[model samples]
Target: MANSNDSWFQTTAAREIHLEQLKQAERFNGRAAMLGIVIGIITEGLTGAGIAHQIGLGPLVDGYAACRTQFLPFCF
Candidate 1:
């Protein structure tokens, strides 16, 4: 009976530890995703490639049009 109880306790402890590690990993991944979004916004702002420019195809539209038939959407 004592041996059985000891084995059960050990299994429970290991399970708890594994659960805690998984929670910590989830938090870290959430933070990393947020950090990536912030960095992406910063990059777009600095590079002047905001939503408007991207949707309008700004300076690259001409290139695309020039080879639209050749590349299906991209020139060269």
Candidate 2:
């Protein structure tokens, strides 16, 4: 009985720590979402692919297209 109760008490501390960490994660996730919203507004409704292209991923996208067209023609 004593050992069983001891295990339960120990778990509360671990559970509290996990809850604290989850709270911190939620905070950062909200901030990131807000930042994305601001970026979307600034870009005037540019979607993810458009934003990637604007930020210099255009060539990477083009390269992927070239690869698909050449080797894996049925890829994407």
Global lDDT of each candidate: 0.76, 0.76
Q: What's the lDDT of the predicted structure labeled candidate 1? A: 0.76
TM-score of 2: 0.51
**1-76 per-residue lDDT for model 2 (tens digits):** 9999999999998999999999999999999999987786678565545655766766556678657556445433
Off by over 4 Å in 1: 50-76
- The candidate 1 region of ten consecutive residues with least summed lDDT is 65-74
TM-score of candidate 1 against the unseen true structure? 0.62
Q: What is the TM-score of each candidate against the true structure?
A: 0.62, 0.51
- Candidate 1 lDDT, tens digit per residue, 1-76? 9999999999999999999999999999999999977876886888877644556765454565547546344565
Segments in model 2 whose C-alpha atoms lie over 4 Å from true places? 44-49, 60-76
Record all residue pairs in model 1 with backbone atoms less than 3 Å apart, i.e. clashing: none
